[model samples]
Target: MKNQTTTTSVTTGQMFRFVFGQVLNRRWLLGLNVLALTVISLLEFVIPQYEQYIIDHVIPRRDLGLLTEVVLGLLGTAIALGVLNYLSTYYMGIMSQGAITNLRTELYQYTLRLDTHFFESSKTGDLMVRLTSDISNLQSLISANMLSMIGSIVTFIFVWIYIFIINWQMAVAVTLTFPLMFLIYRVFRTRIHNAFRAARASQAQMSNQMQNTLTQIDLIKSYTNEDLEENRFGAYAQTNKQDMINATQNQAIFSPLIDFVNYLGVAIILALGAYFVIRRQLTVGQLVAYLSYVAMLQGPIRAFTQILNQLQQSLVSYGRVMDILALKPAITNAPNPVNFPAIKQGVTLDHVSFTYPDSDVSENGPVLPAVTDITFTIPFGKTTALVGHSGSGKTTLTRLIDRLYDIDSGTIGFDSVPIKDIRLSSLRKNIAIVSQDVYIIDGSIQDNILYGRENATDDEVWQVAQMADIADFIHSLPDGLATQVGERGVKLSGGQKQRLSIARALLKNAQIVILDEATASLDNESEKAIQHALENLMKARTSLVIAHRLSTIHSADQIIVMDDGHLVEQGTHESLLKANGAYAKLYNAQFS
Candidate 1:
């Protein structure tokens, strides 16, 4: 995982660089955007010249011939400006959409590769907002915001220079008002930035609440808590609405104030230019050109204000995204990882100890001492069952063996090489787990079995299905292997779902198998069938079985009993029953 730093304030040059980096691969779009913007600016610059020509030449002469020519010129300029403006906006739309796709793909890929710890701390909805809204805002900055900023600055400079050339006295008079406008804008900019930031935060908080409500809709219904959930959602929505109203109010007030100042500047220019004309210091045509320049300049200044607000919002969104990108995966493979081919020996836990990252020892806290300094070994070609009461760390220990988490204080090795050093792909490839809770996809039985390994032959699918005793059940269905499982396998009974999960694990043909209470939720018939399948699957593979019912583990080569986080006993069923330890006590209580 790559850790990203918070982008509190990005420089204009840096933002340009980032936008360019995102678009570098899309050269066609880049060329189109540049070409369009240039043509549009060129058309706009020609406007003042056209106005001057019409005012001085055609009007003074009262010549219809020259008037017709001036009208044609103005019409041509309007048509060209409209065409160029359309092209610029059209190309920007295409680029913004493409850039959004690229950014979204990268963000999703990076998020998936992040370590489990990051997920433990972040909410799904918050991460989702970062993916969708934040990235979209960035695209907005690249497309509309950048273009507006560029166009405004270009127009402001070009128009000012033309005004100076036409009449310096009027240009200077209009220029004098800019310092005050800049000061006023700086204050407005600060308020808008803060307001937009608050709006984004409020929106993210509301999204989080909505997601929570939807995910737990069933729970709320069962508990008859609709009114309570509605109140909670209402509170969140209200907060978001308030923030948006504040932001909109600030923008409304800011724009009108800027417009008022601009009008005042135009009035000043008119007064001064008329004086120059009356005194014969400047021509009427020159005054008309100066006023035209002032009108053009106002468009860019207002545009600048809008772009500044957008830039601030983008910065805030970018900072949120960077917060997630900065998190490094706590569990990852070594740089030069080695492969463990066959698990020739066995899996070993040498004084392994682990504690959850955000847990403490308490009833309400996370399970205490998830795993203590426990040492164990299971030889190849045997079944070793892990039996314990609930919350006795059975599942946690299994997770450690699979390297879902690293033990804090000991070594977990596969064939004697530290598990962390072994290539993660190789380690997981050789192990298969059928957890107590089965998950079925919304697809055919064939699809589910083949999910264990893509490109699996149909023959291989039937073989595992038969081995797990699910082939007969599928054959009885109307669609057989092609039958849909429906949402989360809701169409199948708990026992059927368990059998399918078992079939999935068997299809993997891994050397090390883990059955975490695999048959705990099944009926007697399904349990017997699944247990028989387990026996066949365990023939040559080293197996770790967690069974809630004693009947499921009677044939184990060794049964390890755990209490809280410590191992209390390990022996064959008969031997442990005679030893009268934790395992024996459990067996007698449950099966005697």
Candidate 2:
């Protein structure tokens, strides 16, 4: 089977364009955000006008009466500014939070829908960064952070307009230095982008290294390699440190350059205004107002520069995130797939064969089939046991049946219907597989059991717990079903975790069940107990089992014996024992 998953790399500009369209769905909220900021900006402009009135009119006339009015205007403006600021911040916050929430939720669901191969070629740490850190960085840009920047831009523009009206010549002289700010950004923009990108890469490596150590802590200690692991962690930390330093250094350079450019503007305005005042072209009150406007411009200019830095960081993050969003899953439902109500007959493998997918294959290199010409029929409501040594393609057969991986050249049919035509949801929902190693969620015993069916009644949960033979242990605990299982169910024994897994399956009540060496690793007592429970549960259901122990399959309806990649024998257990072939040899060797 051939499948293609294309991950087309996109640039930051393309990613930004995509994001703008995505957030447009919340256009009403975004519009309200703009309205609020506009009000705040107008109010900010009104306050500066009051400052100009006090300096130009009140002080020059020595008018005490205008002083009272000016003080009242300032007080009133301050109160209005507070309220407008709150409204502006609140609406933008809502819009930003809503945007990020939608993006994060969609990305999470998309990750879940991705096929097995995508994860095989990806790293958990990098994925985590996309979901957590990258999403968070984007969130800041969409919300309050963005609103603040917009307000700054409005301030810069409005203040410039008033300064021109107050003294055209001085306005031109002062703002001449504004182009210098652009030149400074041009010099360092690429450096900052590269620094942040490198920092993010280094962060992912550190996260991966940390995750590796935490997951394998026991092995590290058992091998007494604490010092080695510490050194490795130190190396990752050093790389991360250097990357952050580079990014921070660029940020540091950005702030000071912004300050120098803005202050230079102020100095130019002061010198020109003083000359104009002496030449009788500008009044003292007008000169004072000009100085005040220059000061106001300083905050917005610096703020906008900081926002530019944030924008660069946001663009880098979005570029990485879009790369994941653009990938197509290897396996997806076919157009007009057949949805089976139920499997009425049985599974049939007619001349089936498979080979593992090899991405590293070279021309003229050897290729090997994992299973070759393997053919069999599992009759409905019966157990077929696959008994073989490791790497004998036993588990591979079950995986193909479950559609975890597609076979190379084969017709795998459920009830004689080709599996490829079936709807994946319907197929997976009706089937369940219990592997040798069970993944137990860290939660209450009841929570783990109820995870199989969210809407299952507590009575239904208790019944399955009993059938799986885990009810007694759960009841003996003080917390009963509510007892915590710890991480990966570490609080429970291996046998306990296996039974808990069975309880989960029992809750799902799938029609087809595949047991992959479920009882192979347990003690004799645990094995006997779980096996008896499994036999009871397997009744009236289609069960395919891979057993490491020969005795476990003695009563299996049909026994399949495989050697290398070929099926060497197939018969009932006793008939296979009498054949004096591969199955007989394997059985005798195990017992003897």
Q: Which predicted model would earn the best lDDT?
A: 2
- Enumerate residue pairs that collide in model 1: 3-326, 4-325, 4-326
**Per-residue accuracy of model 2 over 349-400 as CA lDDT, tens digit each:** 9888888765556587867788999999998889999988899999889878
lDDT of each: 0.80, 0.81
Clashing residue pairs in all predictions, respectively, total 3, 0
Question: What are the runs in model 1 whose C-alpha is more than 4 Å off?
Answer: 1-16, 360-369, 523-526
Q: How far off is residue 349 in model 2, in Å?
A: 2.2
Alpha-carbon lDDT of model 1: 0.80
**Best-performing candidate as measured by TM-score:** 2
lDDT of 1 by residue, 266-371 (tens): 8998899889889998777777777877987877776777566777778778777667666667778999999875777888889988887766457775556777
TM-score of each: 0.90, 0.91
Query: What residue pairs are clashing in model 2?
Result: none
Off by over 4 Å in 2: 1-26, 165-168, 295-299, 351-358, 362-369
